[model samples]
Target: MSEVLLLLLLLLALGPGASALPKPSGQRQTGPQRNKLLLVSFDGFRWDYDQDVETPELDMISVRGVKAKYITPPMLTMTSPSHFTTITGRWVEDHEVVHNMMFDQKTNLKVPHKETLRRTEWWDTGATPLWITAQNQGLKVGSFHFPGGGAHYSGQPIQRHVFETPGFPDDNETEWRENLDTVLDWFSVEDFDLVTLYFGEPDNVGHQRGPDTPERKDIVRQIDRALGHLRRGIDARNLTHNLNVIVTSDHGMTTVKKRPLVDEIILNKYLPLLKLASFEILDYGGFGILTPRPGREAEVLESLAKVPNITAYSKSQMPYSFHLGRSQRLPPVVIQADLGFNLNSRLIVYVNKGDHGYHSGEMDMKTIFRAFGPDFRQNVVSQPFDSVHIYPLMCRLLQLQPAPHNGSEEVTRALLVQETDGASRLVSSLLLLVSFLFFFV
Candidate 1:
């Protein structure tokens, strides 16, 4: 199919559940501007888990700055897409990273002559991330291994560095500190305005060891310690005196109780009205995407409405808060198998541990967000915040213009220091002086 027609097909598949942009609120109000900012992405962290344990680094940040109690991400709640939203202020449709694995259109013989990996440009389609933006604005940008950071950032002049290796290790803390040292080393020679670091142990360990497992608990503590080390590193450089720090995550995790197995024939028996576009036979059950053939969408929708152990949604029916759009990468009819039903397979497998990609009821779906710096206040606002909002807020804090994909509402004023009449008076005096000087000249 032609590229235009293919994109249209994808948009139709996204259905009506795609999210729309929200109205602008004056949440990006300026504060006493800061000289630098640091963002640390703690992948796959939950808002509430192992509650008995204390997050001292985060708690310290709260005491010094502000903490939003919760930060929710868009549906599918995966890493790449959420990270895209968090940094670019766009949704899955705009970013074009609908899922972890890009579609292999060449696999279908119908497109036998089609080019491979051509349409699978997940990293290329989105708006420039914060690092790219900062670099373009003549500010130094440094990044550790984020999901999409390794991809070409439209040839932007941002510094990309890998401080940590993938997969979990016993000495994750050591790796984290080493990465901190690398960031510090770079900062020592360069005056970077924005820095991004990512710690992957928590997410990896949680997925393998389960959130309730002792191994996962230890990993969380280690992550907290790493954050402490990070703070010390910043303190060592004296950067904190005028810098802003943000801690956040991409998505949360969920637990699986029993893997539900479904026969392809049995599933097809009930899904006659729907045309299955993609199918994966997973350990717990199956993961699949469906669409209506030709004009049969209404029948498929009605059939999905009657299905149990499944949550089916049209593209338009998706939560508006996510801000997704009708794009070709999406399926018009989406199906989320019942919680705990793992689609088991050798190549595509879940570790039978606590993981994500289930329902909203999963605690692992709740992520984290905490910011501290000269521009923020010491308020503990417990209102739930969206992960997508962090990108826009970061730009606002750095006093940089936002990218075209920024669909998020700016953070509320409660997160920042209160404006004062004294500053206003100073501004008035400066304006009056400039006006007088202009007239005299």
Candidate 2:
């Protein structure tokens, strides 16, 4: 009877079954940690998206979970790099996923944004993402339509990954449900410990219809509906108790002024028009990377300095505050247009009504962050923070040893419940003492 009782106490101390068992002292797990985690990102969800829409689901979670006023993404706030930064806990410079597209300086060749995601050379440069890290530390993780989800890091595959279509699409409500179901199945049936799910939304609509337009509002409603379904799905699958959920975004959207309405930063308009043969221009909405041909650095700088409403810099000279200049993949010259403007090669027709890729300090570039579940505190709303801090938060959640990252575990400590092991450990120790007495004394 004493032995059976001691076994019961041991099981209780270790958590439901043995999945939450702590590793060695170096990788000591903390808190009454949850059994699993699910990270969801709705592309281009601005910090204030909940204000205008009836986001009952998001609002509900804020009260039941933890909410951040906002979180700043890294510089050149686009999709892939920012998402990678969230997972790796590194700034754009450290992770080296500087932009959406991949480019080779030697050949001046470019890969489309979608193709760039699948290319291993760009993603596996150095940092190991959460999927790789968690799996390396003995956890099963899945990625569903997330940026860098499909690529192999150092030739190692994600335990599970899904990205059926290219280009973040919108008219796929049914598919969204199917994907959520699949993830829930992974957690319940396949015993996955962590999964990252992504949805391309308001970001796509915002680009075509502008951030403040009615079409954008409709997309926001769609996002709320999706959130509602996820909430219900969690409860239905009995995962609300053990599954921690964090919903966030890559970056926010801002309106872009077209040529007729406002002056576009046309590179040719600047004096000493950068010769086509002497440079490689990668212009994406408000951000542009200019790779000057050898010996043409002086000419490129002079021409870019002449352009009004544009902040231009060489890779070595990029503003230190932005934390964006360290990547070897970055080009010779970089330019950022002032808000409400875009960098265009030529004053052409058809501009995206909305765009990101702005400097990190732009309020419009900030993103959303929401988290909840067993391990998180209730009804705590936090001040704005950088997204890089999220990776450390996740590492603590899983009790896994995090790879070298720039974020602080303390910065996100406020969001979690205080660790409570004193009573449990004491009772467990007493039980062991009694068992020893019964066995030998």
Candidate 3:
């Protein structure tokens, strides 16, 4: 068979669900403003949030554009790693951002997530992100409070970026609108080809008021209002036809189960914390990492395995799907709690009613994914896929050659529209022509 036929067969067989790479397509950067993309992330939006609260904006977008059942995040799902996975199209293993906090194994030091954003060493760990890849291809890009936006990757920073203040009000509608307007201006005035805007939402309220609370429902309404404002801003700038918008989140939140209802994994109760581990990152939401002392690896794993409502895995023994075992930054052993339970250190009380950071398989751990634009199919609901696939979709929408990433274009290509389908048709036509020539000649 001709190479074209063989390639076409491969794409047909693999493009819908397999880890297929996207072909750089007919798209080119020509005019002053080429194909533009806007990525918006509302932190900790569960897949079922709209089902609980009336989200007219999200509903309207689904009717007019594309929606996914949900998107699965990388295991040990947290803000930094999941967001990095979405933008870099790499698992935590490839991107090496395994946690929300940056932990140093040698010094046993851990930096908070916001402070880690400015730590170049943490973000510049050899993986190139979408912004840097686009800029390298001569596309102007910007970021608004997205994770890793403040750091340099491959010695290149996003052309324009903003960071939220350490203590910004999470639910202020006015502040959210201001940020949305600024992003719109970046596209209309500054001509950014791609921009990532993040909102620390419903995530904050989810944690404070619990995922099952009325407070979370209220915050969801606030988030929907912000989405409406985003739509209005895009329309006001005459960018409706030029821009593609993807709104998603890092991870979903679940209600935390306390004692008497379910036994939380309090590590110090099972193992002598001071005796076996050199460094312990615990009392967090749903995950913990332990660096065993020079000779106590086996003991630490064994003791942790005995903790109720949790699973313990040595680095190599982690489930292959977790995609976290290969990072040198990760600890020797990792512990993850059941969906609603959290891993805790002895005497460190975690009072938050809702939390995340569990493995991503649980229904409650799956998050939202919605996209709308001139490039997406209207009223189509796609199947759930991993968050990693998003990076390649953005690359295709912007017509930029993607950096090294683990995402497959096949899974997300179904959500796209005429241009993407036209590319597929062109490939099929080429295959037929090549086959005819090979057989007749």
Cα-based TM-score, every candidate: 0.75, 0.87, 0.90
Can you tell me which runs of candidate 1 are displaced by over 4 Å? 1-33, 106-120, 163-171, 259-307, 314-322, 343-349, 359-363, 406-410, 418-441
lDDT of 1 by residue, 342-440 (tens): 443233344456567665435558887778776676756548866667777777667676678645534554465533223344456556555655776
User: Model 2's lDDT to the true fold?
Assistant: 0.82
- Pick by TM-score: 1 or 3, better one: 3
The segments of candidate 3 whose C-alpha lies over 4 angstroms from its true place after superposition are 1-28, 260-262, 419-441
Order of candidates by TM-score, top first?
3, 2, 1
Worst 10 residues of 1 by lDDT: 108-117
Sorted on lDDT, best first, the list reads 3, 2, 1
TM-score of model 1 vs. true structure: 0.75
lDDT of 2 by residue, 172-222 (tens): 888888888889899888879999998888798878889998888887887
Per-candidate RMSD, Å: 13.4, 6.8, 5.3
lDDT of each: 0.62, 0.82, 0.85
Q: Going through the candidates in order, what is the number of backbone clashes in each?
A: 25, 0, 0
